[model samples]
Target: MSQNGLRFTLDVDGLTPAATAVARFTLYQNLSTPFLLTVDIASDRSGLTAVSFLEKNATLTLWQGNTPLRYLHGIITGMETGENNHWQMNYSLTISPPLWRCGLRQNFRIFQQQDIRAISTTLLTENGVTDWVPSFYEAHPPREFCVQYGETDLAFLTRLWAEEGIFFFDWFHPTGPDQKLVLCDDVAGVSTLGSLPFNPNTREVSTECISELHYRAQVRPSSVENQDYTFKTPGWPGYFSHHATNLNGQRTQYEIFDYPGRFKDEQHGQDFARYLAEGFRHDAETAACASNSPKLWPGKRFTLTGHPSLTLNREWQVTGSVLKGEQPQAQHGHRGEGTTLSNRLDVIPADRTWRSSPLP
Candidate 1:
């Protein structure tokens, strides 16, 4: 009959060492027209245990209003672990006497959830110009590390890296003979890495030798709203300071430094050290608001400070539905009740410091 669009963002952080996965299912319906059912299903996985070279499985179903239209079954494989892993499926069916006025529904199930230590957000650049990278560290050492960047999804990778105190190498396409490598240090020192001996036509690092040897420094994005904001460390080496704020000019989040190395699980010493170094003091008043709602205001502003590290893989999605009257439809062309599922996964090495500021 009719269809409506829906947008959703599901963020799951894994605290275990085993691999963990999540799924999302969607159903659609239109009450104004005759019976026409449509269904879409998707899945994703994230966490430390999700290796890049592994196969995974997913299940999906669909329903019209209340009656079953068709049943659909399928599997998803070749899932990689990191900041983002995803799968999707879609199908439609026609009921024997199309019913008018219907609705849709979806469900998701995780087959496993162990060894999935630490899951966070995946960031991407807005203009598709740059990429995010990640460095690994041990789960137990001390010294907090993190990253900060612009408002683009690309910033999420930096945030994750800042929290984890990891590093990432990003190879960019050489523009001209005057190609310059500008290394911006936490201090005010800016050094040039010089021009490439050979033209690197693509934005990829041609050789590990050349790329690894290039000038390396923590990369930070310039602030648009506050030009006075600096990307320098206060008293720490290889670290930077940053501030986060909300629309009301309230400082909701902030970061001090990023320590390089793994954490040591000695008598909660690592946790205490992290709490002292990479932690941010949330505004009690604002934090109370976040605890009360599932939705965030569109213009809310967040601050971050750190160096460039890894990038995350992310996607944009919207949901829709098809249905007849109040009956349910089936998925695909099968005669069973309809269902849907979606999942995502991220795997960080155990030897890394990934920490996040308090939410305000």
Candidate 2:
């Protein structure tokens, strides 16, 4: 049986059964998906929440698993908030069996300033609580931050205000000690301030910086083997910028570079970091191909070949595969009689995607 389209719904209710207020809900899906989905919800004229307030839209695909499914596009839209001004989101999806399933999972949190009051209250309150208080004076505007987990390590960065709100700053690899710092002002813009050296013994970066807005510190490993680090910042109106580098010092083979919309001040810096990490994972996997590595399996004769066409043209190819000896077992397996072994050969493909392509 072919899977069908997805259906989503959200509900919001007040702490009191009948107490409700104007609440807005927006749902966004990364364009990286085979399809895009977005939903938005708002109040109605009668002040009564109705199902008609829900909006659903999707991007459909004509191709599904070799065969062109008659109707194979995805959708995006939003539903109304609950009666009591609470937020509830629901999504239902349908697609062909085996190839497509409802594999969607979402992580969301009520974002607020890291201030004592906001953190103490919002982080502690439940969905249907009326005891919630918004401390306007004590509220610190939300900053943007991002985190990335590579093969061998993790990195996080955040953009925040500094110097008593006179300057803006960035903190990267914010572990315990070995963190990188950057400061920016209207005159200087953004510039690298310094980096905290990694300490293997303590597994932390020992560094400290005190600015007017906040005090920051970080910790990280001295070195990482196979991993990637990502950096992202909320874009100004009509522009967004994100950068990622493999901990192994490799550049991402394929990526999309474009500006989204401006980010709201209330948006948490950490959320931006998380989004960059997620986007990098998707782009990297799509551009990655298997390669033979001597580091993974030593002392092996392997001829790494690029894409078939590249090999034919003597042009560098991005694809890689191992060459076996007369006896496959002799090349990468145990020598014992009837014993079979396979050695992992490592071969880093020569980057050539940009060699022949036009620069943007």
- Which candidate number maximizes TM-score? 1
Where is model 1 poorest over a 10-residue stretch in terms of lDDT?
Answer: 287-296
C-alpha TM-scores of all predictions: 0.19, 0.18
lDDT of 2 at 355: 10
RMSD in angstroms, candidate 2?
Answer: 24.0
lDDT of 2 by residue, 1-360 (tens): 111221222223222211211121121111101112222322222244334322222222122234432222222233333322233222222211110112221223333334333432332232122222221222245324221222111001111122012111112221221221122212222222232121222212222211011111222111111212224433433233334433234444444432222233323233333234332332232221222111111111122222233332211111122211111121122243321111112222223111101111
* lDDT: worst 10-residue window of model 2: 151-160
Model 1 bad stretches (over 4 Å): 4-239, 245-247, 251-327, 331-360
Q: How many clashes would you count in candidate 1?
A: 95
For model 1, residues 98-180, the per-residue Cα lDDT tens digits are: 01101111112121221112222111222222222222334523223322322323243333333343322211222211111
